[model samples]
Target chain A: MNAQADLNTTVPVELIDEFLKRIPYVSEGITNVRLLDGAQRVMFDLRPGFENQRDLVASRISEIADKLCLNYRPGSSRVLVKREALPGSYRQDPHAELQQRGDIIAFGRGRYGFGPKLVRLIEFFEQRSREMAASFQADPYNFPALIGADVLDTCRYLKNFPASLNLVSHLREDHSVLQEFSQSVRWDGEQLAYDRNGASGVECLLSPSVCFHWYRWLRDVELKEPRAITALGKCFRYESSNLTGLERLWDFTMREIVFVGPAEYVLASRDRLVDLSARFLDELGMAYEISTATDPFFVDSYAVQAAYQQGFELKFELLAPLPYSGKKLAVGSINYHQDFFGRSFAIQAAGAPAHTGCLGFGYERLALAFLAQHGLDQKQWPAALDAAITASAAHDKA
Target chain B: MTSSPNESIEQRIAGAVMRALKIADPGSSTPLRMGSTPGWDSMGHMMVVMELEKEFNTRFPPYLLPQLVDVEAIAKTLRKPA
Candidate 1:
C-alpha cells in the first residue's frame, strides 16, 4: 500500500541522509521510505495492513525528525581518503551468488551461516589485519562473546545506545523454576513461549564492540609504556528492521587494534591506522571513502551525542561502495576515546588517565563489499587479494 | 522570577549547574569542571545545558555543547552577542 507523510518542518539537506538511515528502524511496518519535496516530506511504502497505522508511523517520524534532524548543527564530514572504481569493475549481486552456491545460509533475520568460500574470505581479511597489527607489535588476544553487564554500564553504552543493547538471560537455577519452565515451554508458531517467572535476572550481554573488552581486561592497570592489542571477536547489536544481507547484521565478526597510552600516542596510533587502512584498501583496488563519522545514537540523545562526536572529529569510518545499490557500507572505523574509557576503568598511563583509540574492521562487510565490487570470479579479483586467497588455499591443502 | 540584577553570569551559571546536578549551592568560589566535578558526567552536562538555556532564555548551537566544559567557558559563550 502507498502511504506518505509530509514532515511539518524542513530537515536540513545535510541531515537528510542520516534521517533516511534511521527511518527503517522507526517502524517494522515501514518497508521503505523515500524523500519527497526535497527534504520536507517522506513517503513510506508500508507492509500490508500497516496502512491503518499510517498516522502513528507518521507521528513517530515527525518526532524523530524533531529530535534528530532539526536540533543539531551539521558538522563538516570531511572525506579523508577516496578511491575511484577499479578499471574493469562492474556492479553485480553477490548475495544471490553466495546463496545459490551455499556460501551463506540464512538462519533467521540478521543471522547467517557461512560456507567455506565466505569463511576463507573472512579469514584472509583477518590475517591481513593481524599483519597490520603485528607491525605495531600489538599483542593478540581472543575474548569471549559475552561481556558482563557491569562492564557495559561502565562504558556508558546504556546511556548512548540503549536501543541497540541485547541482554542475555537464562532460566533461574532453582529446580522448581527449571521444572516449571520445562513443563510450560512450547513453540507458539512465531516464538517460544514459557512462564516468565522462571527467567533469571540478566547479568551479561552479547558484546556490542570488541575493543571494550580490551579496556575491561586492562582495568586499573598502570602501563609503563604504550600498549597495543589486537583481537578478533563476535559483536552483536540489535539493528531492528535496519538489518539486511551482509551489510548490517545482529552478530558480526570484528577485528580491533586497540591502543592505550598518553593522548598523543593514542591519537598518533589512530592516524597511523587510518593511513595503513587506506593503503590496504588501495591495494585491493576497491572503491571506498574514509570520512569523519558519528555513531547511531538513540534518538533522544542523538543530537547531543552525534554533535559531540563530529564536533571533535572523534571517529572516522572506512566506507566501501555497494556497487549495485549506489550506496556505501562502513566496513571499518578509527576512533579516539581521549581518556573516556581510561577514566571509566581507572587505567593509568603517564601518571594520569590513559587515552585510548581503536581501529576496527567488520570482516563480513569487508568480504561482501569485496565480492560485490570484484565479482564472484576469482580472476576478476585484485591481484593482491587473489594471491592471498591462492596462498591460503595452498596452505590448507598442504 | 527574575534573577537578581546584581547577579554575575558566573553566579547564574553556577545556579544552573547546581540545579542540574541536584546539589546544594557549592558557593561562588568552587570551580566545577566537566570531568573533574562529581556528577558532571555526559548526561549531567546535557542537563546543565538544558538548564542554562532555560535560565538564560537562549539556545546553544550543537557544536558549542562540547566547548561548555567549565563555568568560565559557559559564561564566555553566554556573554557573546547572540
Candidate 2:
C-alpha cells in the first residue's frame, strides 16, 4: 500500500491530483496550487478570511495524513495554535440580560444602539478621549466618513483589504433604469440582482480606519517636521461569525491620534502614546493589560506580515475583560506603521519615507468593558464615570 | 503491523525527507535544516511529517515540525525502540 517506499522515483501525477481532490479542505480562498517536489511540497495559495484559515489547513493536513497513513502528533507544530472559538453568535447574545433591561439594543448583526445610561457612559469616555488628545496636543481633524474609491485604491486599502472593502454605489439617474434595475430587488423573496449597467459604478468605499484621512491629506506633500493629529470617526469592517457585541463589529467608532515623521520620532511617539494610554486607563481605574497584537484584517502573505508585526511588537492592544463571553477584549491599540503609510502616500520626512504610528481607542468597546466590569447598575459604576452620569442626569433635570 | 526490523527510524526519516526534497546524492552535504535546504520549506516540512508518521507509525505535532531540523532530529523524535 505504501507507494514508492524509497521515494527515489517520482509518483504518478494522477494519484497526487487525486489526493488533492480528496483532501477535506475549504477551497474558497485558494488561488494557486503546486504539487511538484513531492507530496510534502503541496502548497495552495489561500487568501485570508475572517476565520483562522490555518485551522482548516491543519485539519486537511491531518485528513491527508490519515489517508496516507501519516501520523499527526500534537505539541510538535507552530506555537500559534488555534483556541476554542468563543461561545455565542448574532443569534445568541451572551448578554441577553443587558438587552432585556434595555441597557443595550442589538439593531442587527454588526449594529447596536445604547439606551440613555449607556449613552451617558459613552459620553464619559468621550471626555477621557478629549483629555487624552489635549494632553498629546493632537491637531484635531475630521474627514469625510466615506472615502472615494479611487482614493482608497491609491492608498492600497483595496490591495490590503479587498475582502473587507465596502464600496458605496448609487442607482442610475433615469427612473426607467431604476425600474429596470428593480428586477434585482426582491420584494417578496431575497434577491441581490441589481443592474449596474445603467447605475453608476462604485464611487466610494466606507472608511475602514481613521488614519486614511491623514495619509490622503499628505499625498505628494513633503513634511519638514513631524505632524500629529487626533481624529474620531466611524469605521467599517466586514466580520463573519466573529462579529459579536462590541468585541467585533461591522461598524464602530474609533478615536485615534496618528504621527508621521522620522522613524525615531515615530517610535518615540508610539512609546509615548503607549505610556499615555496606560495612564489614561489607570485614571479611569479600569483593569487592562497592554499586550502585543496584530490587525486581523490581513491573510495569506499578509498574515505573515501580521505575524512579523506581532514578532516585532509594533502593534500593542489594551485588553480589558468584558461582561459578555467573559473574555478579555482589545479596547484600544497602538500601532507603528514603519513607513507603510509614507511609502504608499509618497510622504517624505527628512528626505526619507516617513515612519508613522498611531494610538486608537474604541469608545463603544470601552463602554462595553465598563459594563462588563462595573455591571448595569449606574450607582455601582466607577467613580469618575458615575460622577459624569450623575452630573449629566442633574443637568437634564435642570 | 510494524515496520521491518531492518527499516530503521533514521532510514525512514531520511527516505521521507529525501523523497520530499528529491536529493539524488544521499551522502551530499546540503543541511536538512529548515530554510536551509530546498526541500525543507514549510510545505515540504508538512509532507515530510506526514510521510514520517506513516513510515515510523509515530505522530508529530504541528509545532514540532519547525524543530525537526534534519534527519537526526526526526530520528530522535521518532525514537524507535533500540
Candidate 3:
C-alpha cells in the first residue's frame, strides 16, 4: 500500500476535527475560523471516529446539492461557514462531520479537497527529476531543493483604522465597481503641505504588499501545543478574477510544520522537515541539495534583507526547472523565524520567549516539479516514479 | 427550511452569509475582513450578502448584511428567534 493508503487505514475518525480545533485559526492566524466543504465529501464521512459528523455534514450537503441540482453541477456548492454553531445545533456535530478520506495529501484549512490537482503536480515534478538524472548520468551536478508556496507579504493601511470590515468600507467609499476577489487595491495623490512640525492629516504614499495579511483581533494564541509538529495546506497567489486553474490562484495549500523550544531544538525541528523533504524526493529517485535561507517576510528591510539578498544567507529556497513555467520554481523553504512570531503571538516557554520556525512545502509545486522532471503523460512516467506516486496514495489508504 | 414573513430579518442574516462565502476566495487562509485583505472590496461585500441571500433563498433588508463583521456575529443573528 502507498503512504496515502496507510494514512487511511491507520488514522482513526475525528482526527481532522481534532486537528482543526487545535489549530484554532484555519484562516491565517485569525482565531476561531475554518472552511467546512469542498471536493472530497463522501470518502471523509466513511473514514474512522468521525462517522457521525461526516455523515451529518455530508447529508446536509447532499440535500442542498439535490435541491440545487436544477441550477449547478454536483460537488460545486458551498456548504457551511466555519464559526460558532447554531443555538440548538451541536457546535461540532460529530454525526455530521466527514471522515477526511481521500487524496492522502491535505488542502486548504485541512478540510476536503484532495483531487487531481495535487496528483498532477506530483507527476510533473517527478518526471522532471528523472530527465535531469538521465542527462546528468554521464556528468555531475548538484540536485535542486524543492520550495513550496509561502510567499509572505506585508501591508500598511490607508488610514489608522481598527482591524474590521470598515477597512473594506473605506475602499468601497473610494471605488464602487472593484471586483470581489481583488487581493489588494491602493489610493494615490500626494498631500499639499508646507514644511511644519506636524502637518494636519498629511497624506503620504505608502507601498503596500499585495499579499494576504491577518486581521483577526487576537493575542497570545497558540497554534500548537508546547511541542507538537504538523503539516497542512497553504495558498500561494490567486489567479485572475474568473478563479479557474491551479496556477492562477492567489492562495495555495502549504505544508507547514511549526516548532517551539530552545533555539537548538527549533533548528533541529527545521532540519527534520528538510531531511524528510529530501528523503521523500530521494525515495522517488530525485537528487536534491539542501541550502540555507532566511525569512521571506524581512526581505524589504535594511541590513538583514540585504544580507539575505546579498550576503548572510539564513533563508533557503528550493528551485527546480519546470516544463510549465519554464523557470526554476520554488517548491519549499526551510526557515528559522527565531523568537519573531513567538513574540508577536506572546508565546513563551522556560521563562523566556519561544523560538519558532517552519519548513513549508508547496505540495502542488512539488507535484509540478515532479511532472516536469518525469513526463506529463502517465503512461510515459518512469517505472520507479510511477511506483512511488502510487505508493504514496496507497500509503495514505493503509 | 421555510420561514415566514415575520422572519424577513432572518433573510437578511442569510443574505450576509451568501455574500461572505461567494466574495472570498475559497482557498484563502486569511480571515475574510472588509478592506483588510485584497478581494473584500465594495462589489466583494455586495457579493457576500448576495450569496447569503442565495444560500438562504431570502432577501435582506437594506443595510442588514454590512452589519456583520465576522462569522460568529453572522451565526448569532441567524440563530436568533424571529
Docking quality band of candidate 3, CAPRI definitions: incorrect
* Candidate 3 lDDT, B7-77, residue by residue in tens: 55544444354345444333335554654434444335545544555656654443244454555565565
| Candidate 1 chain B, run of 10 with poorest lDDT | B24-33
Model 1 chain A: worst 10 consecutive residues (lDDT sum): A84-93
Ranking by DockQ: 1, 2, 3
DockQ of each: 0.36, 0.14, 0.01
What's the DockQ of model 3?
A: 0.01
Report how far off residue A334 is in candidate 2 (Å). Answer: 0.5
Better of 1 and 3 by DockQ: 1
For model 1, state the Cα shift of residue A51 in Å: 7.7
- Model 1, A191-310: lDDT tens digits are 899988888899999999999998999898999999999999999999877788888899999999999999999988888998999988987778899999999887887877777677
Error of 3 at A312 (Å): 5.6
Candidate 2 residues A1-398, lDDT tens each? 00111122243442343344333233454434455466554455556662356455645544443443322121211221122232112223336767898877887777898778778877777777777778767888997789888778876678766667777878879888887877656544433655558767888888988998899899888999999889889999876434667677889889898899998998988777777777777666566777776554333333234434543456787887653455677888888877767877899999887888888888888877766665666666557777878999899889
Q: Which residue pairs in candidate 1 have backbone atoms (N, alpha carbon, C) closer than 3 angstroms, thus clashing?
A: none
Task: Give the per-residue lDDT digits (tens) of candidate 3, residues A290-371.
Answer: 5543222211122123222212133556654544444445676666655544554566656555666555566655654554
The C-alpha stretches of model 3 lying farther than 4 A from their native spots are A1-226, A236-249, A294-312, A323-326, A379-385, A388-398, B1-82
- Please provide, for model 2 over B1-82, each residue's C-alpha lDDT reduced to its tens digit, 9 standing for 90 to 100: 2346688666666777776667654464654665456656434555666566667666554434445778787777667443
